[model samples]
Target: MKTALRTTTKTGTFAQALEDFKQITKVGLAVSVVFSSVAGYFLGAETIDYKVLLLLMIGGYFMVGASNAYNQIIERDLDALMKRTMNRPVPSGRMSVNTAFIIATVCAVLGIVILYMVNPKTAMFGAISIFLYTSVYTPLKTKTPLSVFVGAFPGAIPFMLGWVAATNTFGIEPGTLFMIQFFWQFPHFWAIGWLLYDDYKKAGYYMLPTGKKDSATALQVIMYTIWMIIVSVFPVTGLTGRLHLSVTGAVIVALLGVGMLYFAIRLYHEKDNAAARKLMLASVAYITFVQIVYVADKFIGGY
Candidate 1:
């Protein structure tokens, strides 16, 4: 009975630790970012390389995880003030700042080293992303509404990072990928900002463009959505280097944009959290599907 009790306690402790790690690193968000990197890799590579692809996945996750961990560390007090964030490991007292710092440091170093194996450019961009997220974006969150725009830089890197990893070059193709994701983030994050305005205010975060959930903010969201849609279809002009899109792909992407735009318009009219939440979901679906369409157009449609 004593041995069994000890074994059970050990298992429970390990499970709790695992959960804490996931909470600190934000596993779901990290995985989704990795998905974009992988999609970009598929788009840029003339021939698939499973080894480099595997490295990209692991290295990308570590970089994003480190960024999130550091962000939580910096925002622990602010996080504790917001209901949406109070349950996170650092804010909840489930983990110490020093421990989180250690995890972030380790992940950052390991991520950079792993990415370096893919190519020096890949590792350099990974480092830049970490610095932009933790050093620049995290501190700016409570300072100004423009932080969303700043955050978009690092958020946009993974997609282009994949192209760089695959081709070992940064050119028009990767630049175009970067621009698409960069523009898309405005609507995606602003919708989230609108829905969480109350909670974010508790933490002193100014995420919305107009610093309030009003028509002006919604208009900016619509504007950015239109820009994103326009950029998404630009490849069909056959001017974006190897990242060309077929006519069919461009039409489908335009349709997806229309769907997201409809939600944005609804939020503009409704001006309610429900509408904001739907717009947020639509933005996510639109970005993911657009990436899929781009990759599919490359391989299947031979564009």
Candidate 2:
């Protein structure tokens, strides 16, 4: 009985920790940071500094966690109203605002310090990402539908942030990565916005252009999906200079873009919740696979 009880208690604790971590930051942001840094390492001449990369990952996680915590604190009321977010630690009162604030502040400070150790430019960008996310984007969600576009700026930074951290300089390679991600965010996020439009409205958040689900929103998603494909393949054309890809690499990249395009088109035509959900999942896979391909191609003497 005692052994069983202990096992049950451990399971519960693990669940709680997962919930708290999601509330504090998010898995998406953490993964993005790691991927971007890896991509950046490749961009910075395919050199890796394990120590610096470790520091940057730690700092990135902390900063992202801090931003999420602050967002929850500010949106606690709205969060409670949205079915999707109602059970979050803050809205559910599983954690208090005061405690969350202290945790966030400490994390932000530590993140900045670590990033500074990596490079001043990286540190500055990290600070800027946090500032824009917490200070500007969070509040704007309730005020306007355009907030999604505004939020994309910070959302797209992690990939490029890695390049700057790796090279301690901003140049064409990082810029290319930045542009790819920047364009990618729209279709990716719009798919999510479609899936959660109703949930968002209940909380007074306008995540879609029309603040309603319709063809216009879906069309916009399709357009951006097309743009994302175009940008993702740009490196192959030599327009990205040092980031140029070889024919084989370009073909692989084009295949990934086609995968993304397939989902986007499915979502556009179906205009159903299930299709949108699938598209969102596909978008996640698309980004992860493309980043992996990019890093591998760079290292393996691929184009």
Candidate 3:
């Protein structure tokens, strides 16, 4: 009976630790980051390499996970103040700061090594991404609204990092990909900020540019959505280096942008959580659809 009970207790502890790790790493967000990097890899590679793709996906996920872990450690105190964040591992005492730090260190080291196995530039960018998120973006949240802008830099890197990994060079193609994801973050993150404005303010995180849910902030979201729409359609013009799209794919992407813009406009009109929630969901759909459309367009058009 004692042995059986000990085994059961161990299993439960391990399972609980796994759950804590998931929360700390923000698994869903990390997966989305991996997908964006994979999309960029596909766009840039002349001949797709499964091994490199696998490394990029794994390295990217772990690097992003490490960044999240560090962010949680740094913001544990502030996180405890926010209802939405209070349940996170470090804030809730489910995990210790040292425990989380070890995980972050292991993940960062392993992730960078794996990416380095791919290319030096890939590893360099991966390290930079972790530094930006943990050092720059994490602390700046309570200090200034421009934190979102700073956060966007690292957030935008995954997409371009894929291209650099595949091509081993930095140029217009990756530049355009970087710009697309860069502009996309404003509307995407602002919509999320609008939805969680109260929770964020509870933690003193003024993510919205205007520092409140006012007309100016909503207007900024709408304007960025507009620019996101424009930049997304650029590949179809045969102007964005090796990334070209067929007319049909362009139409589909444009239609997807319109869907996102509709929500952005509605958010501007309502300027409420409900509209912001809808816009947040729409932004996710817009970016995923646009990326899928780009990859599919290439596959079909033999580009």
Candidate 4:
């Protein structure tokens, strides 16, 4: 019995550590760092610096990780109330609040240091992203539907973070990238809001525009999705100068936008869990592929 109990304790400890890591490094945060790094590469800075790129990724990771850690700490009780999040480390009692706090603080310091080393502007933005995400948006989620909007500010920073990392300056290129991601987030998050409406409600999260999974919210999803596609194609117009998309690349991007549109329209018409799920999947694919195409266009010259 003693040996069996010891084994069980060891297993539990390992699982807790893993869960803590996931809560700190959310998949969305990792994806943002990757896409933004690629965007920085494509922005065609006067000179490419792989060292800066490495720092951007490392710094981005810590900023995101810290924010997520703090979020879990703040929402521990609420997270336990939600089925989808009940298994989270803090809420499940797998990890203590004090441990999470220390980890978050350390990660934030490391991230800021790396970003500052890369460029002061990038560091400033990284700090701002963490502040907005942890202080403003996390708490606002339970209070107002506008939390989504506030959250989008930090959520959209990764794309721009890359640009600042590369150029050490904010310009039209980063602005355009920011706009594209900013618009895309509404539809993407709303679809998630729709799918997780029940789970979110259990935890007092007001994710949707109406805080209800109805036609009203679905319509908003469609509207923002349309806007997302439009802004994504804006670069092709050459209106943004340094961020211009060639004709061929623009056409390819448009086609990808149409694919996202199809999913958005389906969600609008169907409003079912399956449709929402599909839209969520498509939105993830859309943003990731769109960024990839944008970067590839610059290098491959588009087919």
Candidate 5:
């Protein structure tokens, strides 16, 4: 009986530790960022270097993981105030600040080192991303509505990072990618803000543009969605040099944009959490679908 109890306790402890790590690192969100980075690499690389790709994937995840850890540390108190985040590792007392700091430091060092193995530019950008996310975005959450704009800087970098890692230069092609992501974040993030407005208010986070759920905010969401769609279609114009989008690719992106716009419009009309939730879901689908199409077009349409 004693042996069985001990085994069960150990198993439970291990499982909880795994869960704590996931929550601390935000595994799902990190995976999406890495996926975006990989897509950028594929789009830019003349020939895929599998070794460099491996390093990018591993290094990118650790860098992202470090950013998330640091963000939690900064928001540990705010997180405890919000219902959704109150149960997270640091806020919940499942992880110590010191432990998280150690994890972030290790991840940052190793991530930068691994990225440096690829090239100096890659490493430099990786470090900049961590710094911007932790130092700028995390604190700005409570100060002003402009935090979203500031956050977009680091948020938009992964796509461009992938291109830079592959090509080792920041040019028009990667710039186009950066612009697409930069604008996409407005609606994507605002919709989340809309859905969680009350909860975020608990933590004094002004994630929305207006801090109020009203027409002005909704109009801004719609406008940004339009801009994001416009930028997404620009690559098909051949003006972006290496980042060409064929005819079919253009149509697919337009369709995806329309889908997101539809939700944004609904959110405008309703101005409620239900509409906000739909928009949020649509925004995720739009970004993921558009990214996949962008890469797929490179292969099937061949510029």
Candidate 6:
């Protein structure tokens, strides 16, 4: 009985630790970022190299995980004040700050080293992303609403980072990818800000463009959504280098944009949390489907 009890306790402890790690690193968000990187790689590579692709996946996850971990550490107290974040590992006392810091530091170093194996530029951008997220965006969250704009920089890099990893170049192709993601973030994050406004206020976070959930903020979301749609179809213009899109792909992407824009417009008219939540979901689907369409167009459409 004693031995069995000890084994059970050990297993329970390990399981809890794993759960804490996932919460701290935000595994879902990290995976989506990796997905974007992989899609960009597919768009740029003439022939796939499995080894480099694997490196990008691992390195990208570690970098994003490190950034999230550091952000949690910095915002532990503020996190405790917000219901949405109060259950997180550090804020809930499931994990120690020092432990989280060590994990973050290790992940950052390993991520940069692995990305360096892919290319120096990949590693450099990875480092810049971490710096921007933790150093700039994290601190600015409580200070000003413009932090959303600043946060978009690191958020936008993963898509282009994949292209750079494949081509070792920062040309119009990667630039287009960057712009698409950059513009997309405003609507995506604003919807989240709308839904979580009350919780964010508890932590003194100013996430909305207008510092309030009003028509002005909704208008900006619509405007940025329009810009995101325009950029998503820009590859059809044949100016995005090897990242060309067929007319069919462009039309499908525009349709997806319209679907997302419908949700945004609903939020504008309804001005309710439900509408904002729907817009948020639509934004996620739009970005993922748009990336799929772009990659599919390149491979299947032969454009």
The C-alpha lDDT values of all candidates are 0.94, 0.82, 0.92, 0.84, 0.92, 0.96
**Candidate 4 CA-lDDT value:** 0.84
> TM-scores across all candidates?
0.99, 0.92, 0.98, 0.92, 0.98, 0.99
Candidate 6, 199-272: lDDT as tens digits: 99999998999999999999999999999999999989888788899999999999999999999999999999
Higher-ranked by TM-score: 4 or 6: 6
Task: For candidate 5, give the lDDT of residue 110.
Answer: 91
Lowest summed lDDT over 10 consecutive residues: which window, candidate 1? 294-303
RMSD in angstroms, candidate 5? 1.0
- 135-154: candidate 4 lDDT, tens digit per residue: 99999999999999999999
Candidates 1 and 5: which is better by TM-score? 1
Best candidate (score: lDDT): 6
Off by over 4 Å in 2: 1-19
TM-score of 4: 0.92
Clashing pairs in 6: none
| Per-residue lDDT of 87 in model 2 | 87
Better of 2 and 5 by lDDT: 5
Q: How far is candidate 3 from the true structure (C-alpha RMSD, Å)?
A: 1.0
Q: Model 1: per-residue lDDT, tens digit, 155-262?
A: 999999999999999999999999999999999999899999999999899899999989999999999999999998999998988888999999999999999999
Q: List clashing residue pairs in candidate 2.
A: 245-303, 246-303
TM-score of model number 2? 0.92
In model 5, where is the ten-residue run with the lowest total lDDT?
Answer: 294-303
> Would you list the clashing residue pairs of candidate 4?
none
- Per-residue lDDT over 227-261 for candidate 3, one digit per residue giving the tens place of the 0 to 100 score: 98888888888888898888999899889988998
Candidate 3 residue pairs in clash (backbone atoms < 3 Å): none
For residue 149, give model 4's deviation from the true position in Å: 0.7
